[model samples]
Target chain A: MTAKTTKFVQGNEACVEGALYAGLDFFAGYPITPSTEIMELLARRLPANGGKFIQMEDEIASMCAVIGASLTGRKVLTATSGPGFSLKQEALGFAVMAEIPCVIVNVQRGGPSTGNPTHVAQGDVNQARWGTHGDHAIVALTASNHQDVFAMTVEAFNIAETYRTPVILLLDEVVGHMRERLTVPEAGAIPLVERLRTSVRKGVDYHPYLPRDDGRLPMSDFGGVHRYNVTGLFHDMWGFPSDNPGVVHGLIRHLMDKIENNAHRLAHYKTYHLQDAETVLISYGSAARSALHVTENLRARGERIGLMELQTLWPFPAEQVARECGHAKQVVVVEMNTGHMCQMVRAALGPPARVFLANRMDGVLITPTDIKAHLRLIAGRGV
Target chain B: MSVQDYIRERFFPHIWCPGCGHGTVLNNLVRAVETLGLDKNEIVMVSGIGCSSRIAGYLDFHTLHTLHGRALAFATGVKLSRPELNVIVPMGDGDALAIGGNHFIHAARRNINITAIVMNNRIYGMTGGQFSPLSGEATTATTAPFGTIDPDFDTVALATAAGASYVARTTTYHVQEIRKRIAEAIVHPGFAVVEVMSQCPTYFGRKNKQGDAVEMLRRYKEGTVPLDKQPADPEKIPRGVFVQRERPEYCKRYEHLVQAAMTDGAALT
Candidate 1:
């Protein structure tokens, strides 16, 4: 028989399938809107796959559970949207400081506090970057469609395991609730990467936080032979908390370097019609979908406009944006949130270029026509 | 064996303040863990931020010093991930029931197979004895120095009502009883909670003139009425196993359901 044809699945359901296929063995989450189906699907499916699914009391517990489960050598994950994501901030910070690998799915909705729970909004773009207190590094992926939700969720787990930090799969209500035909390849067809489990023995006195020659530590599972402490406080190579300034400084620097040094591996962005264009449109998450619609329509009208859609939102893809927009006369940034991604685009494009922002924070997604109007306005401005 | 042998000497004298009930709670926990014959490697102790949470640092088990009021959450994760391993949480009044109150209630509600030892001294011990959710009515704490006007929580009753399959309460003075309860809580098939009525001799003690550590234990001994001596009235029933029933544990039920589903799929074949 021929391989089964593609089936239409909700983005959230596809996310669950992708996570299960990626070897996600544990899911600890509290139910919230838009993202609730992700948890609901996992709750039904994880057990059949010889995994555990826990509906925690709240988002804070959901986060802590994932971290604790991850420490025990399980590929753990959690899903939340808007306010639930807010409650997970401290635990996310703890995961970063302790270098525990976990995946957090933040299904975006109109936010600040329980705003537009049933509606779509990409307002969490900035929160995904700076929601957690203190200076920290993060990797966030935005899925524009259901198919990408499946692909990105798997990638989120892999990136989390590889980097030994929490990876945010930022999906908005649009993509999360939307149904699309999904074509998932055989599990082994795509590579599934687990963390680097160092072969360190117990009583050898290992440091869990010790950086490698490249300033990145290959994490060993907690129950494995390696013995080390894991704490939220700053510490040296050993997981024990320390007050030593040298250890504190080195700890922060190493955490930053581990991701920064490998920015090329972590950064992902897609370009459309950039080969010949006078105006470039920068967008991410749900806004990217609308931007694509506008770009295609404008292309049909014989307008030379390009679309730069960001998949990885952090480590900012600075060089790629600067390089691509080098020859373009003007870059127009369209985002659903109040101009958060646009600010980053402006920063990356710098002073020599004129970057215009078309932002909407009224708890509604920027529609294709809305984006088209902004493109027309930007073009109206002589560049 | 010497106290030094029971505890990693380097980790002690513990950070617990002089005469604090947390030390007593910690002593019982260590004893309980030891009695279970759990290999230190096969056991993991996780704690949230607070004085009681500091117990992880003193124990020899593989430990996770986690975020505040999140010990139960973390422990749930740890236990679910490695069902073969034993996981315990040592959290304080505020850590267990205030910032983490929702987790506490839900963990009980889910009846996850794990042991939660809450050191209920009725105040936030680490944050300088602030009035916690479990503090007695009209009691003075740092946050309620003028005398607390807020109603205190009955954690044992709350947990029992929330569906903890095993629930018990004992005070610091009842060390042996507490140890037995801790061991029982550990072996229980569902979410088991042993709420130890500890004495915060440092802040809660000095503030309320509750007496020194020794005297505080004395008061605890004098104050608690044994369960056998309690009246029949539900409202005034003395603390003990406020509720105990054997329900299918969270993991076991999940395992059974999954197996049934898999078998059903097989039969379809």
Candidate 2:
């Protein structure tokens, strides 16, 4: 009911609209393939909306700049593709270590290193979860269509603000470039998470890294009345670098536990004909689009096929995934990358033998027919 | 306000080796802010990793100790977002000219209002005295046991070529000059670079047999001449403000751009 005005736009454009809707105050990014439109649109859009945008020299600077803006109590974002994302990993880890809130969009393209610039790939799935070196936790989200692209982009910012961590929005080249209809929601329709600034008095001590009773760390604006230090070193509650054994152990644990503990609550997905399906298809990003197409076509012929489209990829919802696929006779994990999500899907389920993968890696969108062939094989028929 | 009022006293018993010139540079910076009477809450001190980078932590302001060679990039974001706030970045020799060289030039190119203080110790002391980009040829370092072959970068020259509105150089021995240059840089409204030639006596001195901290300070006084000294000799390092001129700062230009862009957005709607 809140869908206000409908327009046809690319997924990247929808992401830009969603960021403004989420009250983005600052953005700094370097342009790369597939993800360039997001930065290009924001470059033109931010200034008019009374926000700030900068095209930094490179991806590393872009990531560092957003973290800097976020400390000044601004909601910030940066977008990049595969190679750019790789360049951003160190600074992204710095954001996590310093507990700064911001969003990073990797409109994923092929490559371990510049393999394909204009082609789609979901190969960075594992990279998002463990790209930054250290035993730290991360939040990664994705969407399969233009509408979900808009919603998930907003959700990514919300998660960043609430958790005080960097949130990655993963969209493949196909989803990023594909134009589709999206209904822009009414302003204030979807709730937003505002930054929680400290209530400590101006002259009083403000701990920049201390979490209160409910695991929420209230932050003081970087240039605000309270003067405090922010650093990448293992730090005390006062935000000063500390190498004490207790301090280092406690800080890393808190960073990991904060998001990992709330993974189930953060899990988001959509089910199509899942209630009574015998064959379940698990997919995310743009691959879910093909999976849904395959499910609907098979369902029209009286087959019990279902599609589970995931929105939250990291802090992956293992328990819920196991439960959803518990009753299904066979589970097929579909993706563009060969076995990234398939491995996770197998881990989430009890009988890994029933879990299979339907995938493509030639810079092509997985088709409905491509999925049906997997189903025919699963039904003990020749491919 | 007293000069002590500018420092975070709790962080005292600071993390510098004995006779390290970085402490002197820190002292000069503190007095400079005190002279300006800038509100402690309005100053954001950012620094990249190195011995001199620790100055950000000792300052009682909004401090950010960021990744190596990236302080200027981070400071650019901070100052551009809140142009009214005074942002200062203190970086070490290699931190500034080597890893962070690109950011330094670009920040100067944008002419964003930021005071970049390069504490030039001429060696990478924190990681145990490796030869830095600014270490110059014939300098002895841990990485350059046979003496370095890499040439030094003239900070003033690099900053001037990068379009900085203000460029100056001072040494730790000239403590008063360091303070004066910092105060002048702060009041200037565009990108300003102040390179202070602080000594790393423990490494750059002992490795090259340049004697103790006091001897190094004496050499600073004897080696460099004032910029206006009559004969402009090629042998001596000249010390003074190199460039000071006016230009529209990056943030103010963006503000005017926003005013025009609002009209552009309205037309689109």
Candidate 3:
């Protein structure tokens, strides 16, 4: 007898497989609809691999625990949907300030406040960027389908470890709960990034907050021989809270520069049939899958409409989008939420590019036909 | 305790105000670590934003001073990630019970294998003298100019109800009793909360007209009734090791279950 080679898995379950393959050793989460399967799978699987799983009382605790585990040298992860994501904002800020590496999967549902628990919405697109209170750079990935969910989750882990920051895997409820066949590669088959470790030499003082001239720093874990202090307040290389103006300026500049310097490597997007096109469709997350399908369908009908799919939703992939949108006569943005990512597209397009937004906030996905209909409307107008 | 110890020597310039009760609480905590005989490398201290939270940065062990009101959350992560390490958190009243109140309740409820010592000084001494959740009703502070009409929380009772395996309370004046309870809480093997009824003489004492530090100590000694030895009056219930019991520690149970699964896999083959 042999094990089944391929089994149908929910997008949420594929997320767990990705985390495990990415070397995630701890899962601290609070259960919410649409994202509950990620928690459930980890609850069973993590303990089997000498990893830890904790169903925290709420999303705030969940985020804190994940950051905590990351500081102690474990690859940690957590999952939540709408209300839970709202609860996690403060701790998310802590992760940003302290530069802890962890992965947060927000299987998004409708709401400013738990509007529809079991329904799908991409209302969190802007939230994922500015949900936490601070001026900081965020690394977020949007998954279009189950396969992308698995692959992007692994990418999220690698990016977080490489940069030493929290990476959000943004998924809508439609993709998260929907079942599909997934083929996960063997653990060693894919690329995995581990955080840079330090060498211990007694008598040499180690500054955990030491900023590289390039603005990046390696993490020093707890129990290492290095005498290091880690704090949330603005600190010098020694990690003690400092009120000095120069130190404060240097600290904020360095923190921002670390991610900004490597923005080219961290940013990613996908383009579909943009060659010799007058009209283009720009979308992301679950809606991007529809955009891709609709772009293909429109191409078959001799319509020259291209598609620009955002893989890295944050830091916006502004340069690539500017190049694509700059050429097109008209660009239409399609998404589940109203005018969130569209605002970014408009900003990137500037003036002279007629921008049309097709949005829905009714806890339902925007279909390919709906987007195509909007494109046809834009195509018909002359004045 | 030796002044030459790695932990103590590094964490000097302790920030407690002169004759403040937090010093005694810190002293007892250090002694408890000494009594446990755990290696300095194996101990991890986590704290939040406050005067008490500053202890982590000074300590010689692996330490993290996380965001305000989120120490237990971070401590939970540290302890769970490295189950072999002994974790401790010492926080002030507002840092532990008010801003961090949700974490406090849930940490107790999960009964994670960590010891949290809350220095309950009844006021937010670090940020001027605002009334804390643990400050008693009718107590006067900077924020509560006339009187605090809000009811104070009985943190020990809250921990007990929240499922802490070991819960205890002692005033800073009772140094020996506090030291003993700290040791007991450390050894209990589950989520243990030792609420040290501390004094903030500069802020809380002056505002309430509780005299100087010495007078505040006297008031604590007179007001609290001991758990073992009872006062005749019902109102004078003493504060000394109020709750203690054995329960399943969270991380240990998780460790056992995983080991069992490994064994079962071996047997199946």
Give every candidate's TM-score on chain A: 0.96, 0.98, 0.95
Question: Model 3: what is its DockQ?
Answer: 0.56
**DockQ agreement of candidate 2 with the native complex:** 0.78
Candidate 1 Cα lDDT to native:
0.82
By TM-score, the better pick of 1 and 2 is 2
Which candidate, 2 or 3, has the higher lDDT? Answer: 2
Give all candidate RMSDs, comma-separated: 2.9, 1.4, 2.7
DockQ of each: 0.53, 0.78, 0.56
As for candidate 2, its clashing pairs are none
**lDDT of model 1 at position A136:** 83
What are the per-residue Cα lDDT tens digits for candidate 1 across A1-383? 02433668888988887887789989988889989998887776777667788887778888999998898889988999999999899999999899998999999999789899988888888888999998888889887877778888888988888888889999988888888888877757668888887767657766677777866567766566654567898866767667889988888887788887777888788899998888898888777888998888888999888998888887678888888887888898887877887788788878888898887777677888787677667768532
Model 3 TM-score relative to the real fold? 0.94
Candidate 1 collision pairs: none
Instruction: Please give, for residues A194-243, the per-residue lDDT of candidate 2 as tens digits.
Output: 97889999888788888987677988897788999999999999889899
lDDT of every predicted structure (CA atoms): 0.82, 0.91, 0.83
Pairs with steric clashes in candidate 3: B225-B237, B225-B238, B226-B238
| DockQ winner | 2
User: Which consecutive 10 residues in model 1 chain A have the weakest lDDT in total?
Assistant: A1-10
